[model samples]
Target: MKKLFILSLLVLASCSPKELTEQERWEKHAENTEIIRDDFGVPHIYGKTDADAVFGLLYAQAEDDFNRVERNYIWAIGRLAEVEGEKSLYSDLRARLYMTEDEAKENFEKSPEWLQKLCVAFADGLNYYLETHPEVKPKLITHFEPWMTMYFSEGSIGGDIERVSTRKIKDFYEPNNQLAVSQGLIRTSDNEPRGSNGFAIAGSKTKSGNAMLLINPHTSFFFRGEVHMVSEEGLNAYGAVTWGQFFVYQGFNEKTGWMHTSTGTDIIDEFEETIVKDGSKTSYKYGDEIRPMDSIEVSLKYKSGDDFKEKSFMTYRTHHGPITHANGDKWVTTALMWSPVKALEQSFTRTKKSNHKEFYEMMDIRTNSSNNTVYADADGTIAYYHGNFIPKRDVAFDYTKPVDGSNPKTDWQGLHALEDNILVLNPPNGWIQNCNSTPFTSALEYSPKKEEYPAYMHSFPENYRGIHAIPLLTEATDLTLDSLIDLAYDPYLPGAEVLITGLLEAAKVAPVETNVAKEAIELLKKWDFKVSESSVGMTLAQFYINTYYRSGKIPNMVGNKRISRLGRFEYMSKTASPTERLAIFQQSLEQLKEDFGSWKTAWGEFNRYQRNDGEIEQDFDDAKPSIPVGMASSSWGALASFGTRFGKDTKRQYGTSGNSFVAVVEFGDKVKAKSMLAGGQSGDVNSPHFSDQSQRYADKQFKDVAFYREDVLKRAKSTYHPGEKNK
Candidate 1:
């Protein structure tokens, strides 16, 4: 038996391609690419061709954080269950529902020759990294294939497919199960708002007469790495690339810059399918005809104990899409845009666009389904696209919820044209800003009129950040890169102005006032509605607002029905009872005293920025040394958002998300930019690059980006090929 097993292993080894060894292939690729590490440890990759640039980009990504690269792919390709166990099985199923392994491979085969080359290079780059670094062990994927790139084509952290509910999937798949209501799911208007801020200023508003862009992505810390990729084939792009992705998700070329903010457009929709079963056959009603539903068996592997286990599920799909779950008695299927090949092409092509015309032509692809784009070019053109891939639906059926799948009238009537979609091009105000807000207010008088667009196009509420940004951009005349950076990090918390003033009024009207409450009110009264590390007023305001949310002092605003943060503040200020307002303030004061030994604690003492390790989901410790971060959450209207989440026993609020990668770019005859990452490029704790920029990030101090090769070499700390070790 041992001899037979050895012979089988030998046969398997011999069956592998023998044209060139994996090591030799890696050496060849390394020769085609060179990676220059700057003083701050950002990789500036130079390659002979576009494919070679992608290869070098992936190779550099692996060196910086192979763990994240592997983890992202593991989750993307529906193999997360094999590593995380049974609880993640639904997530895997959700991925497979939209695109199966066979489909991904087919998609790869159907890609254009140029894109195919990039795909092959992507796999080759990562595979070479794994082959050369024998010490780095991948949890699941040992060898990457070209097809795997299809699963994670676009750069958004969670793509449109993530809108499907895993809990609903579990309810439908499991036997004799009651549907579970998803609790604690974060919504757009949640206390910690998760999104990006993009500001595009044309030449008219800038001091240097050059269009400027603010690329501030509010994602979890270390979610993306900052890199500069250059190729002889005109692939010179610099900015943030999501870990494991070859393309720069948010960045700029020589003449243009683009930033993406999550759009509130109704793109993903659920359809209530009328399912019918006859004996062993199942069909769904479509119009007046009955169409047989597609059924497939999906086998999943999960880690159990010391061994691997398997679970097989029979999945069903309808014409609308995959039957994700049941809505009451009706089977519900989710419909979302899933054009991986085109999406990948559009994502990669956008980085190379030189001007507004080229960028506008790229938007014709219409595969960017989940984001609103803010664009600026060296030609002094600034634009804002509300949403790219909007499907035209019948006005009779509301797309915000599940529509009737049986009625063909409810189906999407192809995609809307780029011109039809809500777009702002060179608004007379010379600026465009989108903080995940309605496009109607993107610019002052020149903004797109809400009444002119379809009702489905502008359902998102106007946020406090939008309200806060309008005045600043409207009054601005001479803006520079440094001034734009300062504007992005402005400390004024507009939401607090309404809520704090209400508290002051409540204090004056209090029938029974405690000395501590009066002192707190006095501090609030003197506050300028701005946040700073040492501001005691900010500390009080944060606690008071948080306590209001937790104590249920106000009515719960459920889902889309929820009002804007500014509206909520208005309600508290104008409608809430004076007694309730004072009571909420009292609770915050007491909690502050209990947590930090005093109610007069500074905001810096409670709000902190700490990074103890490189773990994807970090653990925070109050005892560990951490820097004080002055920025507050976007919920409170802080443009430079620094949101926090606390551990079970931790006292200080440690920042977990917000302001991950921030860049200010000035597009002139030569593109000049400054960027800062949350921590640094490398994720290894032992690597000096891991936490080198943590203090600078907290201070809002950005490092000048090295876009040109000459600048990169000037700041180069070490330069080498992929396989070579840097000293």
Candidate 2:
């Protein structure tokens, strides 16, 4: 542990440059002709030439945090060793198998003309910045290859993570190991966030009769939103792209807009490879046949600082993928069959698509990464697509765990035809949304059945976010844009009134007899679920939920696998666990009593987004940075949600990370949307814009997203080409 800490320190210390005074000039070849600098410092790059816009965007990103940019690049280039020394060496080795410089060069050659041109233009932008910012030290390869970005894209946020950390392959068996495994499971939630919130109140359901479409997607802060990079030759788009990716990963176009969240559709699998070494030949036997296997040895090298002399190496891999340790007697190497090229092609094509016909045309290309797409258009059509490029496989065995690679049955059959996947359009409910919930509940009674697809698809069942979202949407009527904004800011306690009612009802007697403890229980008993800034009951409830609620099987299965609101109310009605419950009850009572002297305080007060340091307080602080708002109650949401605490005044509190970016696209009319991010655009700490949007984001507000060329220029504050002087 000490060694690990020391290694981290050295890696961080390495960032300090001895020659920090150097400056290089950035040469701009692309045209620069737009203004972009909102109050939040978001760079709205506009250009007569799409390449010019992209060049400026890249340069702007570099200016913010070249370190992260470099880090992303380092991983992409399989050069982790250059930063973290021996510990990261193995990860680099695994990356090398598929993304070597030579391979990237070859792939670049075969790439489509449009993609190739974008790659070159993007690469040149990075190079131009490197030329200008000489003092900013870079380790390993300073220049980036377009394909390197493609390599890092292969990882699963929650998939391979469960296979032990890269450094402690040997520690996979230790009883002491406590690294969080929930992240991987989170990636495989009951419903992966594939579907976006999409539904239209047609003329029949609306009093205005204009027809309303909701294009809401709960996705990663940077994953689903980014500006498009297109040239007059063919590229023209404007919206958000997944951070670190070159293409406009997903966003709105002129005629339509779309958003994506996680869906339950499963596309990745793990296969346990069996190795057999012959006298001089290396091969593996599957069933009755012995096939020659390729051996890939990755020796990673790392140096913390400029002393380049200090380096370490680690090893990982198999013919399938990286060999990861699960525990004693088990070595698992996962095979991920994602079609990145196809996905990218599909993404580029889909953004420019005009309608369902054009959209279906792109669907035939089958370049989808994992996500559920919700689309809305000016044409009064809204659709939900539970789509993924999933490989078909035999379902007799579980694919979530490692399967015997030697078994021919485990091999992936061809992919399922797109039409086989789950999809619903124009349901009677007239509105549909997926806050990472099951597909069955996407609409009224027309939801797709699980029995229709093979088990290998590995999609999620119903999850919590969708659970709460359904009720909220159903409760509202004549929904307008303001109502949607209010829904996004709903601060209801997790499990809301249901769990509280269940707990209250389940209790046999007050867990604590003391006046203070009794008061806390009574406060909870007679309480509302709203998490308004002043509710103290919400604070107590949130803390209790945060402490106890987690991912696991429910004890009682009257109807479902989850604890029902009635069940919660019943349990809490009379405290059951005397000692344990007493301690918790006492603790909760004391904390609330001590802080505000009463439990009646609104949740927003105590559970505030501490606006300390001006803005760092906005993103919530879950123990694990990865699982931002993964509460079981789904108060915040499955894919995105925020947490905040109110100060003494109840208004001066802090807001933390939640849904960072939001977009709603209408197919042909205009993009109606709200977007927020944790930090302002600039990475420069002192810049006001750095954290300017923290309050607005916490306040559930968004600046207008300049999507069209004219809207951006009309609202331009200041813009120029990459490397162009300030004007």
RMSD of each: 6.0, 11.0
In the range 27-83, model 2's lDDT, one tens digit per residue, is 434345343655455566655555555566666666565655666566556666576
Enumerate residue pairs that collide in model 1.
none
Instruction: Give all TM-scores, in the order shown.
Output: 0.95, 0.79
Error of 1 at 367 (Å): 0.4
Q: Model 1, 281-309: lDDT tens per residue?
A: 99999988999999988888978888999
Each model's lDDT: 0.87, 0.54
Residue 654 shift from truth in candidate 2, angstroms? 7.1
Error of 1 at 275 (Å): 1.2
* Candidate 1 lDDT score at position 160: 80
Query: Positional deviation of 655 in candidate 1, in angstroms?
Result: 0.5
